[model samples]
Target: MGLRAKKFTPEVLLSAPRRSEGIPNSDASKVLYSVSTYSFDDHAKASEIRLLDSKSQESSLVTDKNGSSEPQWLDDDTVLLLHGDEGGVTHIKVGPVQHFGDGSYIAGTIDGPVGNVKLVRIGNGTYGVALTGKVKPCGDLYNPEKAEKPVTTGREFDSLFVRHWDHYTTENRNAIFLATLYKEADKYKLSELKNALKGSKLESPIDPFGGTDNFDISTHGLVFTAKDPDLNPATHTKTNIYLSASKNFWLDIAKGLPEFFEVPISNFEGASTSPVWDKTGTSIAFLSMKTDGYESDKNQLFVIPDYVTPGWVIHHFPGGSSGQGTWDRSPQSIAWGGNDTLYLTAEAKGRMNLFTAAARPTGLNPVPSQLVKGGYITSVKVLNSGDIFLTSTSLIESSLYSTVPADHAKRTLSGQSYYTLPVDESPYDPKSSQLITKYVSSSTHCGGMFGIYGHQVSEISWPGAADDTDIHAFVIKPSNFKEGKTYPLAYLIHGGPQGAWGDSWSTRWNPVLFAEQGYVVITPNPTGSTGYGQKFVDAIQNQWGGLPYEDLVLGFDYIQKNLPYVDTDHAVALGASYGGYMMNWIQGHDLGRKFKALVTHDGVFSMTSQLASEELYFPFHDLGGTLWNNSESWSKWDPSRFAGNWATPHLIVHSELDYRLTMNEGLSAFNVLQTKGVHSKLLYFPDENHWVLKPENSLKWHEVVFDWINEHAGLEKYTVWRAGNVKKQPEDS
Candidate 1:
């Protein structure tokens, strides 16, 4: 027999190489991207900016510094990179893309660290740059000096946002700043910067996950998104896009234009983001939600026709009915294919697929058609030649880059045929429609250092908790597999009650990693999952522990009845965030007794105490109301109510810095299990937030988690400490 394949253990998983989106230059001749690799020797990560020749498929390191990131192209052959100095000051360095490392020179420096910086050419010699930086209480750039400690160490706030995801809120807020980058005395110099929201209370690129995607700049003006200043951020999800007519960077273009004023572009009371300008700079397109409080509402496409002229109209491309053909999915990110055609990436039937729409003349509501499927399209860029550059990831690949020509052939698969695959059918069996296939053959692959890992991935659907509904799930078989051999089951529940398990790759809770450990991993997207449609996504509202729990139960039964390879009797279940909540839910019910063990990470123990979460709007929307008015709603599906049934071996993981679901949630669950005399362990991280992001912490997290499950499954444990030379426990202590 051939040599056995290497197991992707926690150590190997931590060291897996990663690549960011491939950013193509003007003519699509070269691409700039970043590669990240973990160094267990230092318990740190090292990143390098690399340049790839699109034609030759050859790449070389541009910068070896770990601090460098977010490289942007200044022109066809020039690049700008963001880096932080030893003093923590942020600098933008510019140089020719061909000049690997030494030729780059500092273009400009900000007073402090900034994020989401975007540079655009406005005229023949002038370039404009926009960035989000923290502004201090003194209305000046926030730096170490401005952040010096006061006599009083305590912080006081009059707002509802006393703290955010990880840290307490201060007077400092992130604001958008614009400046012109020009050459002076043969050295690049930035002109006096102007604050986009000078005296306004608004802030650009809302906190937590917002970045450069929140704003866009064109030769005509600048457009950005900011939350509604009048509404309480803790309860509302309204963000609007603002447009500035004053061409601050180009005075010639500013003349005869509307007076320099920043004005709201849309009146819609919902979340608006991803503002982008067309190639001609005559129109703008973005995605927005209509609901006021629901953060997960369906995103509607909107475009501004003839924005440069007076009396511009904001046209909305409606879904469902507004004269448009029936389109049920929501677009997550958008880009202009040309002046009129729009390319979008949206979740569809457990996959993040690309679609094409139109930015029309008027009164025309064109439905978005699926242009490409399979793999998660993380980012897309349309070149001037109408070709599309895409960066995507899938269960087998870490990162991928592809170029689809404007006149590419489309393989239109019948939705009925693709969706009607048998529950036992392997995703690869339907190769033409199911496998992760790029639209065009011109593709580059990176981070596939270990080959395809010798595993089979499949997407299968089973009967749902409700009639006429089906629940979808992704399954991964162990790397080393024999036909008739059975494997322990690792049932993983996704965190977003609003999220779905798709053809995507994730560092945390990776199904491939579990499969490598000799278990059959199944990630089920039951009720409340997106990609199915908005109705299914909204089904979990106020029904938290009802439908989704039943769907998962049915999923387990389906595996037991059909997939002979999956041994449900010898199984363990794990989840984080909402998934964590499901684990606690499973514990209190009959499902808890079926699993050999359970792991809950940053889960919710009690819905009644969910008010402790930072985003009050999440609870407000998901739970239906507040504690005073809807006490029954909060207590109906509370996991604490079912704690008496806990008996399985349990691992509770919670991070101290997770303000979303406070540490108390996990600690409370551990306490309940202990009180019930159940075998349990608590893995607490004081430095982590809702997710374990640090490399070292992540490695430890996987080790402890895998060890717990392996112990219950009768497999070799993975914890390194168990092998260390430690004193044996006293017989009688």
Candidate 2:
């Protein structure tokens, strides 16, 4: 029988193999990683830790029973993972990396559910296990089963962060815990867990999306970051780093709780994160932003060398002062290549490129050299052999592994490497010492899925509507695209207002998914969108409906005039968060007449009502000030003011848990559209947040959105294409 052809659908996207960063072992001989894919039969995501042989690029599943995650290399051959049991209890499992299922043992247990656990080496060959878990007020590990049940469900808060991203604040905050880890009689055992931040009123691994990146440990001690307890979380973004030195250089005995010392940050303030310690633990390097309230400020690399010694100096790279930086791009991820070298993954133009810089430079202007160009480098690891292991993604590929030879003698410095920025505004720039390696393609991924349906991705730039500065955008053409055939345009605006459309893979707002539906997808990185520079990102402030909206207009006009293959007349626009707000803005503006339909997900209907939204810093910084003081600016950009002009068929998707924007925004927009007799539909999800993440809900979202756009664009409703046959897929299906 002929092999059944696979088409890229929401189901395919939801089930596509998702891989974690490929982490190299001590010798660089093998790589350990995790892969997760949505299982339709199980109605949940199925994950497995896999060990990859670096030489042959062959990977074997280490464990899949009960779906394991967070794979770490305990040594050159031993693997550590958080595997779940049949009863859904997470266990710290250890096994030989080479052996699949034999000689594995349940190492130990934590007091509560563990998140982000890692083994750190001490001075005397001893390893200390550090993890983040919740603790009670009495300095004991928090156990939900033993806690007293409350009679009332009511919550009272005197602070601004009443509700973060999705959940309400509780008494138990995420804290770092440290314990001695060792093997006895071939069985791993953990000592009594001690609260690393015992007396601190701050939460390490600051909420919403914090993880292992927030803290790091080495032989010297532990270095972690936590929000300042004195500052208001709603309006401030200051997360200071704290260090706790191990007893006698390496704490071996179960002694007193370690004392925490606030790492003096000098003048730099803002969101300090990704505190990473080198293998020797002699220094700690992290990324920091200079501004107080601005979350999208350029991240300047800071290094604290000899942090354990007295009067340790803090070195801020590229830009030493607040809001002053010659390096325009922000480092998204940072890793130590060697003791003196630092590897960074930063956004350049549209792609996340790998770069190498001096870890501790004496020169005033230390420029970083760009390593590999193009694609998004999600994770980077420097092996003991100095080989660089990387995991990247692109518009076409979901996951890719590549290794760059760190040896200068191995390969010639030709077109592969060069300094990213100019030196002294000179005409000539020297090449880097390293060479790029070919990508290690995924062996398990089906070629038919991406090769047959992957969109042709390219970046296009045009003069901005507000200014002559070139504004960039990503254009994705359907794989089945033809030269003569014109396709409907799917204009996608990103959220963040501080975010950009980069060459990266995303489960949500995927360009490939949109283009697969026979549409030309265009995602614009307008003013306020990051990666362009801090100035460009700051341009959107106080001009939410002003410059950004004009930039979109210019972007639309550019396509309509140049790209004859895109049917701009039947185009549809979609966005979430700030993008959602733009959709509402577009609905009430002249741009509304161009699009056949519009989609706004968790958008702001009225600027005045946005005060009710959480994260006061966001609206406070972007809208100029509070509603009371910035009334004129708020009313000027408010989408609700122009609600009478709404006429385009629209879809409003809002969730009950979206505290960032709240459900009222979508509800108010829908009410306005309905009151004006505009063709509109509201897709409400009580279980969802700002974004749709659940597998089943995502599929339903795609179906409803496709139906709405297809109906308005005079196209047929979406249908599943099987082998040589067109199968009708109902709304439920």
Question: Of the candidates shown, which would achieve the greatest TM-score relative to the real structure?
Answer: 2
lDDT of 2 by residue, 126-175 (tens): 57888887778876777676578999999888778887889887888888
lDDT of 1 by residue, 592-683 (tens): 99999999999999996788887899988888888888889899989999887888899999999999999999899999989889999999
Relative to the true structure, candidate 1 reaches a TM of: 0.90
Q: What is the lDDT of residue 631 in candidate 2?
A: 86
Q: RMSD in Å for candidate 1, one decimal? A: 5.8
> Which candidate ranks first by lDDT, i.e. highest?
2
- Supply every candidate's count of residue pairs whose N, Cα or C atoms clash at under 3 angstroms: 0, 0
Off by over 4 Å in 1: 1-5, 184-187, 246-249, 252-267, 309-315, 319-325, 361-364, 409-448, 451-455, 720-733
